[model samples]
Structure formats: C-alpha cells, structure tokens
Target: MSNYKFILSGGGTGGHIYPAIAIANELKHRFPDAEFLFVGAEDRMEMEKVPQAGYKIEGLWISGIQRKLTLKNLMFPFKLISSIWKAKKIIKSFKPDVAIGTGGYASGPLLKAAAGKGISCVLQEQNSFPGITNKWLAKEVRKIFVAYDNLERFFPADKIEKTGNPVRQDLLEIADKKEAGIKFFNLDENRKTLFVMGGSLGARRINQLVEKELNFFKENNVQLIWQCGKLYYEEYKKYESDLVKVNAFINDMKLAYAAADIIISRAGAISVSELAIVGKPTIFIPSPNVSEDHQTKNAMAVVNKDAAVLLRENELDEKFENEFLTLWNSEEKREMLGSNFKKLALPNATKDIVDAIEKLLKKAA
Candidate 1:
C-alpha cells in the first residue's frame, strides 16, 4: 500500500473540493505512505485550495458549458480536448490504483481517462441532483458514492452507495465545545445566537435579508454571528458591534456551529450535511442560481422530514420574520427540529466513503 498512488479530482466550489480533500485525507491516514495527486481546473479555486491542504496537484484547462450561449462556450471543445489529453498523461504517468471524483468539471476528464486505462474509478455526488460530470461518468465508474438516496434515478442502481457527503472532521465534536464556541465568537451565552451564512462567495439576497432584519434581531435581544462571505464583507462590516459580529469568513466553523442556537443559511448539499450534524434549528434560504434548482431540492429533503425550515429566496421577505420568530420563541419546536435533524446525520460519512474505495481496491487486488 505504501507504493500505491491515488488521484482525486473536484473543484469550482468548496462543496465539491472539500469532499475530495476529505476522502484524500482519509486515504492518506489509512495508507500512510500512499502517494496522492489532485487534478483540478487550472484557474479554479481548487488550484490554490488543494495545495493549501498540503497535496500536490495538477491543473487542466477545463470549464463547464454555459446554459446560455457565450464566447467561453465556443472555447469548450478545445478545453475539453486539452483536458482529456492532459488527464491521460497524468493517469499514465502516476498509475493510480484508483481514481476518485467528487463531481466538478475537472473530474470528468480525469476519471474518464483513468477508466479508459483500466483503472478503477469512484465518484462522490454531493447533491440530491447529480451534476452533469458525475452523471456522465456514472456508467463507467466502479462505484458511485452519494449523500442522498434515490440517486439510482440518475446512475446505475447497482453501482450506487448511499454514503453521505464528507464534512470537516472537526465539526463532529461541536457538541462538546459550546463554552469555547461562545468565547471564540465573543458572544453572550445568555442570549440566543443566530448564525447567518451564505457560501464562500456570499449570497446577495441573504445578505440583504440580514441587513433588513438587523433591527428585528436587536429588538429580540438575539446575538448575530454573520458570515457575509468575502465578496460582500466590506458592505456588511459596518453592522458589526458587540451583539453583532460580522465576518468575511468563519475559519473556526466548528466553534461557530457550537455557538449557534439557530442558523440562517443557504442550503447547499455540504451545508445541509454539516447542519444535520450540528443539530440546531435552521432556516434554509436556498440559492436559486444553482443548476436545476438543486439547492431548493436539497433544502426540501430536510423540510419534508420536518427537520428544518425552508424559506425560498423569493419568499424570504414575505415569510422570514414569521418563520424566525416562531422558531426562536418556541423551545419545543427548536428542540424537535434539532433532534430530527441530528437523526439525519451520518457521522461516519468520510469513513464510509473511504471504506467503499478500499473495497474496490481489494477487489482489484
């Protein structure tokens, strides 16, 4: 196993990239000497993120096709050809025992090339709605790891593994860190804390909603830990004070989860997974900008279970106050939502997905 090589590819967003890194980290832990390489889109966040995570990475000239016609769409063919060629070169030289994809533009070419060279491939689909890349690679991959059930509708039923998405390992112990969390955020333990977050880039609508409701929060004596995201931090930072802490990003997310009494967030798949483990009452304002309205679908899964509240971006203004007040004022409702959400958590998701990969490695051996 020491001599074995593994290639992992995913990018474009932290949702895709973090899962790939988590899987890679778990594999590295198990086979301490195993070599790992990452493949990501050249100009995408993963090119910087993967290296920051202490893994060597190669970049491919790849981009997704736009829904509407554009000049970049015209460059897609050349990029695809170049990416596939580079992917083939990487696979041939690295000779990985298995290639794993977490669903992004870069993964398509890399996994396809690995499969073409008789290498076993695995894919991790983070959303209930599979992305185009994972759906395209499903037919040839050895195993398809997914966070949600019913993905068989998109991929071959036999190859699908219902392993939940991997989250930051530190979040698993958030329950024990409440005191530290309060200290870390410098928030009053006596006051209810509302944690607000968009994704890394921030949500324009969510930020606006928070801004509009700042007075409401103050009136109710609720402390706010707002993660406005890097994109909108400057505009929102003026609201920060003793009771209102604003951040461009929350690096100590585990503590943020621990301190949060209620969460107002976008319902990306990874965010949903983390919140399930956090077991706090939550209101999901799903982003409508996503493909196929998947973020809404992701939030609906928990909403349908009565484990969380889903307030669509369009409905936020009309409905957010009622929803937030109801949850904040009722201890029983909050407790029930938290309990139901905890039931949905897969604490061993990273381990389970890695176990699936190990099984494939064993079969190959």
Candidate 2:
C-alpha cells in the first residue's frame, strides 16, 4: 500500500510545468517513498525543467494542432495516434496509483490513456478560462482542481474543486528576500524599482510598450528590472542603463519579486497567482492574442475584486500613462492595491491540492 508510484503529465510552458512540479514536491515531502514519472512533449520546456527539478521524465512525440490547416495540423491524427500508443506503454509500465495532469498538450493523450486503463486521474487547471486540452479531458477526469470560480460552465459540477493553483515553494516566503533581492539585482536602495515580465518567451506588445515608456520611468524616478524575453533581448538590450536592468529570461524570480516596489506584467494565470502572493502593486496588461481571451479573463478576476489594475492591449496607448501615474503618485493607492491583492492569494494551495490527491490515492488503495 505504501511506496506509491505516480504519473504527472503536463508541460509546454512554465504555467503547466511548475504546477506539476509543485504537486510532485509536496507529494515527495509527504511520502518520501513515492516514485514519480513525468510525461511531457519531447522538445518542450518540461523536458529540460522536469529533470532540473530532480525527477525522472519521459517525452512523447506530441505537439498541439495549430489553429489553421497546415502540414502540422494535417499530421495531427498521426501525432495523436503515436502519442496515445506511447502514453499507453508508459502508463502500463509505470502502474501509477494516480495520474495528475496540470494541463498541457502532453496531458491530453497521457491522461486519456490513464483513464482508459482505470487509473485515478485528476486535473489542475491554472487559468480562469481553461485551455482546450483541459476542456477535452474534463469528462474523463475524476476531479478537476481550478483557480477561478464559475468553472462549472465547462466542467462537471460535482467533480470540480476550487483549490487555487500550486506555486513553487521558493515563492511562498518572500518577506525576507527583499534585501537579498535588491543586492542580487544591484538595484539602488533609494529608488522605487519596477519589475516587468511578459512570461518565459517575453511579451512583444508589453516589450514594445516598455520601450516607448522608458522616459516615463525616468520621469517617475523609477528603476526597472525588465525581462524583455529572449526574443526581444537584442532589440531592447540597448536601453539598459544604471537605472534599467534588461534580462532575456529570469531564473531567479523569487529575488525579482522581492526587489520590486511595483510590477507590470501580462495576465497569464501563473503570473497573476504569483503576483497575488508577492503582494506588490501591479498593473496587468493581458495579452489579446491568447485563446478565448484567457489572459483578459484571468486579469479581470483580480481587477473586478479591486485587487489590481488591468489594461487591455488596445487601451495601453490611450490610458497606460495615466493609470500608471495614478498608482505611482499615490502611496496609499499602491499599498491598497498590494494589500487587497494579497487578500486573494492562497499560499497553502500546494498543500490543499496534495491533500486531495491523497484522498484519491486512498480510494484507489
């Protein structure tokens, strides 16, 4: 009954990958004898990151079907068939007590195969607007853990649980990281620092917005730690100065959160969750390009609560300066935003999720 084996399938982006790792870490802490195997897309970020988290992982030859009809889309049927077979083989050999999916392309085939074989399967959806993969797997999963309300619109009402998304352990205790973070970034102790991140690959629109607003940061007496993303580093690196630190990608996000007085970011689900935890005054510019307008829905959840400010991509040019100035000029508003936003944070999410997973494990036992 002990020494349980588990399969965690999710990846393609940090949003999906980190939650899976967070769940795995909590399970490992609670049951050191447990064995874990992660399945992710062969050439994606999870293939690299899962190993770095000190776990064994296997990659499936899978990729998501594109929106438009193309060669990749045409190959979807074959890719899916190949992946399902590979996933079945992995599940058979692993014989997991439970299978947990955090929502990604790989999770679709793997979880479907697990559920087919009568394994306990659960899903953790980080976005307010669930992705296509999670939606497709909704009927098959025994339980679905979600971050936002009103998910019954898409999921089975009885099976849905409102546990917030799991965050990495390093992000949980940031009260003491401020001084270390300031030192780490070589930021001026006297100046207000603004941290800007657009996810892992970087946000092109956000980066363009930042580029145009460099002088505005100067006028407000703000210093910046801007993660312009790897795609735009060459384009934006020329703007870095004593007052600005430009990064292609940031590995040390805990410190990045600690060093910032204010944050400007995209409204991806994981970013929103972490920002709530960091409890910093933030302005979210949700990406318009995302499916189902997912970022906007995620950002609106916080904004509607008066916990944070949100600006659509279209509104940035007309309203960005004024919205930012309103926050910057008023210390009370900054504190209010940070404090109210913190009210929405669920710091114990990882523990809660693991507890539920343990219940599913007992059922299978």
Candidate 3:
C-alpha cells in the first residue's frame, strides 16, 4: 500500500482539538506509514495541543466573528482571506489524499480549500446542533460523521453517518481499573466518590458550587475528586484534603472516571460523549456562554432520555442541592441513570469514523 498523506484541522478549544487528535491517532494506527499534518488557527489551543500529541501542525491566521461588534470584527474578513490563501498553499504543497475537519475557525478555510482542490473531505460534528463552520462545509465535504441522531436536519441525509465523538481509548476499560483508581487518588473505597469536571480550563460556576457544598459532602460521607481547572486552581487548591482531591487537570482521566461513582460536569459535546461511555450517574451544568446555546442542547439529548440530569448555571443556586441529594440518596436511581447512559456509548466511534474515511479514499483510488 502507498503511504497516504492526510490533513486534519480543528482548534480553539479542547472539544474540537481532542476529536481531531483522536481521529488522527486512529488513522495513524491503521496506516502506520501515513504522513499527517494538522492545520489550526494561529495562537489557538490546537497549535499547542497537536504538537503535544506528536503530530506536525501549521497555524493559519484565523478566528471566529465575535458576537459583539468590536475591532476584532473588522479584522474577520482579513483573517478569512489570509487563512484560505494559506490553506490553499498547504493543500497544494502537501498533496493530501484526504482532509478531515472536526470543526473550528481554521477548519472552515482548510476543508474549503481541500475540497476546492478535489481532495475528498470528511467532517465530524460533535454536537447535535451543528456549528456554522460544519454546516457551511456540509455541501462540499464527502461525508459528515456525527455524534447525535437526526442531524439530517442540518446536513444532507445521504451524507450523514451517526458516529459518536471520539474519546480517549483508556476510558473504555475503566470498569477494570476501579481498585487502581481508588488507590491512585488515595480515597476511601467505602465512601461514594463524586467527580467534578468543568472542561480543560474549568467552569467557574461549577467550581463555586463544589466550594459551597464541601461541608455538605463531608457530612454525608462522600469523597470528592475535583478537577478545578487551571484558572481556578490557586483559589481552590487550599481545599484539597483527604476527603477531597483537587487537581488543575487530571492527566489520567481513565483513573478519574474509574474512581467516580457520580459526576458533575459541563455539557460540552466531547465531555458528554466521554461521560456516556463512563456510564456514571452524571449531572450536567451546561455553560450558557456558548454558540447557539449548544451546550444546553447537548445536555438535553441525554436528559430527555432519562440518562443524565441537566442543571443550568442559572438554576444551580436554586436546584443543585435538591437535585444532587435526590441522586446521592438513592442507589437505584444512580444505577438506572448509569445503565441508560452506557447504552448511548459509541465505544468504536473512532474506528467507525476511520472506516468511513477509508471508503472515501477507496472510491477516490
């Protein structure tokens, strides 16, 4: 087999970056000699993250249009033009067999340029409500791989494939690591463990909720494994103790998931996808400060199925305690939620997405 060159673009946040890395990792596994190049917005997280994942990446001068009118808005057109030009040059020089986008500012121009060059393109939409970038690229791309059902409302029905978001592979074997997880965190196995994650940077409101409820958790004999995120680690680090383990980030998420009996998290698309596989009873506090309020919609997909609970940021003060107590007090309720959530897990999502990409490449050949 000939060595295939692939271009993957996604950035701005972990949600988009991680999925792109997951897909790239899977493709590298299948095509060991394949050359991979990642394109991401200059100064964005992916520029840093992609390299850490051990892939070569080039940065594009790109950013999203700000919702508010500002000097940044005036620069949007310039950035778009520059990014597309750079994307075309990259495509021409690299001569990739396929271009895959996980959806971010850089992807809009990169995939558009790749498709214009007659290179096959694939998009992975991690949310039920597709982003503007993915929606725009839908017409040109060869296939749209999605994590949610009924996305035909956004993309062409013929092009859509319901493949769940790619998550860390280590999370797949969490059940077998329970003892190791408990020991790693040095937590009491006899007590229930509540895991709190706010995303890569962390959620301020979620951290506050945990801070406010620390005494309640201790009184109830519950142990906490809190990922306070980088931003708030200094403020929250003082609370770390035997019953509560606070971290800026959990490097081994598999161990964290294994230790968690219950989880409180923000409903970012990738987080929800990983949680579904973790199969823990979870309460989602979706961030309101997102595009199209997509986080709420992401949470509702599982909540509507009775597979998880949704606690809006605004509702946290009024509803968090009662909602949390309801779950904490009942093992039966927790089991039901965990079981239903597990049913939604797409364990082979990475493989399935690669399968679709291979078919497209075969057709091209």
Candidate 4:
C-alpha cells in the first residue's frame, strides 16, 4: 500500500492554479491513499477555486512585490518572513512526503520552507521565460518541470525536465468538431467561426477592440464565439447577435476550440499550452498589463515558429481588424498555422509531470 501526504502550492492566476491542481489530481489517481493540501495567496482566486476542486487549502498573507517603490514594497520583507514561518508550521504539522510548487507568489515561501526542512520538493514552471519566483527557487528544488525548451539557461541543466504544461484532461480529445461544437453554441454551419477568449477576468483592451470589430463579422457573413470573461460580460453582452455569440464564460472550451476556424486569445502560459494542444489558427493579442511583458514573450514563441500571429494590446486598435481579415480570407494560411502548432503539442504533459514527481518520491523513499 502506498502511503504519501503531498503539499501543493501555486496561485495568483489560473495558469498557476490549474497546473498545480492537474499535478495533484494525477498524483491522487496513482496514489489513492495520498493526502493533498494546497497553499495559495490569501484572498486570491485560488482560495475559492482550489476548494471547488475538492481539495483542502491554506492561505498565506503574501502578495507580489510592486513594480514601483511604494508602501506595498515596504511590506514585502515582512510578508515574506511571515509566509515562510507559516509555511514551516504547515509543513511540520502535515509531515508531507513531498512538496510541489507550480509557480506563483505563495510558492516561493512554501517551497523554501519545505526544502529547508529537508523534504523533497519539485517545481513546475509554465512560461518560456521563467518567472522571478521560480528562478529563485531553482537552487533549492530537487527537480524542475518545464513547458518550454532552452530553460537550461535559467535552471540547472541536471534539474530541468521538459515536461510541458499540464492542461485539463477534457481538452486532449477534439471530437466531432462540426456537429458537437456548432450544436453547443447554436451556431450556423454555413459561416466560418472565430473563437475569441481573453482570459477569465477578460482583457479590457481586447474587449474594446472586439466591440469595435464585431459588426465587421456580421457584414462579412462570418460568425464569432466571444468569451468576454466575467469582468466585461455586461458591457459586451449587448453586442451579441445571431452570428456573434457572447458568453461570460465558456464551460466547454474544448467544444469552443473545436468549432473555431480561428482563435483570438491572450498569450498567458496556460493559454499558449492549450492552444498548442487545440492546434487551431490563433491570433494572440498579448496583454501589456502583465509583469515583465510575459504575454508578448509567450506569443512570440509561437508567432516566430509560424504557429500563431501576434498583435500587441497597445496596437490592437490599429492592427486587429486588418490582420484578422487577412487571416480570415486565407484558408490555406490558417491550415498551415494549425498544422505547425500541432507539432508543438505535448498531450502527455500531465503523465510526464506525474512521472517526475513519482521518481523523486521513490528516491526519497
């Protein structure tokens, strides 16, 4: 009988939360007796999301350092010290067999505490460019799971494993794209469909650009599946039409991905990973609002490889309609982009990451 207690930590966004959950779920499947605990930043989305996933979680009074020197920056040292102390208490009380961090603000302190206790710890980094938190955790971590190649520049060569990002299991299978997807959205088969998602809370800049351009699709006999996300739903819902479907959230993203002839989305790490798996012609409108301009870097990874097209958020008003129309008119170019993206798909990422964790667990034993 396998006996293991696991402590998983990651948060701040769905990119961090989902990968941690994916790894936790995979761990539970292989070790039914395992006890799982999630640690996240206090009052963050993960505090709500992790519980809904049927896992117990703890929170730290931790937030990311501000870009500018402010009062929040002054509190950073205090928060870090408090979070480490809290993490140590949690780790000691739980006596976990191993700790895994999926990369977020809370993860740094949690993994640091775990490693200091001489507990085996692993970290999963989703971005092509490693985040500051993961880069700092690189030395203490026993194993590192990565989504992109050439990560050896950021991490130790021996510790890095190119496991790809673990996306939701449901997204792996693209079944009956025409009938299932069209039926789900009540969309017409005669028109070409575009799926636009700008992340869960929605990108205000993307929403503004889409609001301006929705009528163009109506005139051109094209259709749209627009997930405006929760934040901008009310403002954009009035623009919905027979050809232009507006949603606050898409519960079945696989269906949305299947139905889309083309996709417009934010280029967050998780979104890029899912797009690679979905293998659709995607125009990535990278948000300038994020830290380190990571979205632009994420999009460029695909655009440089001919797997996607990139439009900066600042330049959306100028370029979105023209570039989107150019792609819409050319089916051959769309197919080329989709095919090239499929080459980067790592469908077995979840299994690969779980395998890495198990290897460490065995070594610790």
TM-score result, candidate 2: 0.95
lDDT tens digits by residue: candidate 3, 1-365: 64999999988998999999999998999999999999999999888899999999999998999999999999999999999999999999999999999999999999999999999999999998999999999999989999988898889999998989999888888889989999999999999899999876889999999999999898889899999999999999999899999999989999999989999999999999999999999999999999999999999999989999998888878988889999999999999999999999998999999999998888888
Q: What is the lDDT of residue 248 in candidate 1?
A: 97
- Report the lDDT tens digits of candidate 4 across residue range 1-365: 47799999999999999999998888999999889999999999999999999999999999999989999899999999999999999999999888999988999999999999999999999998888999999999899998888889999999998888999778778856667999899999888999989887888888888788777877877799999989999988998878889999988889999999999999999999999998899999888888888888888988889999998877877787789888999999999999999899888998998887888888877
Q: What TM-score would every model get versus the actual structure?
A: 0.98, 0.95, 0.98, 0.98
Name the top lDDT candidate.
Answer: 3
- Candidate 4: regions farther than 4 A off: none
The stretch of ten residues in a row with the least summed lDDT in candidate 3 is 312-321
Least well predicted 10-residue stretch by lDDT in candidate 1: 1-10
Output the lDDT of residue 106, model 4: 97
List, residue by residue over 1-365, the lDDT tens digit for candidate 1.
55679999999999999999999999999999899999999999999999999999999999999999999999999999999999999999999999999989999999999999999999999998989999999998988888887887899999988889998878888888989989998999899899999977789999999999999999999899999999999998999899999999988899988999999899999999999999999999988988889999999889888999999877887898998999999999999999999999887889999888888888888
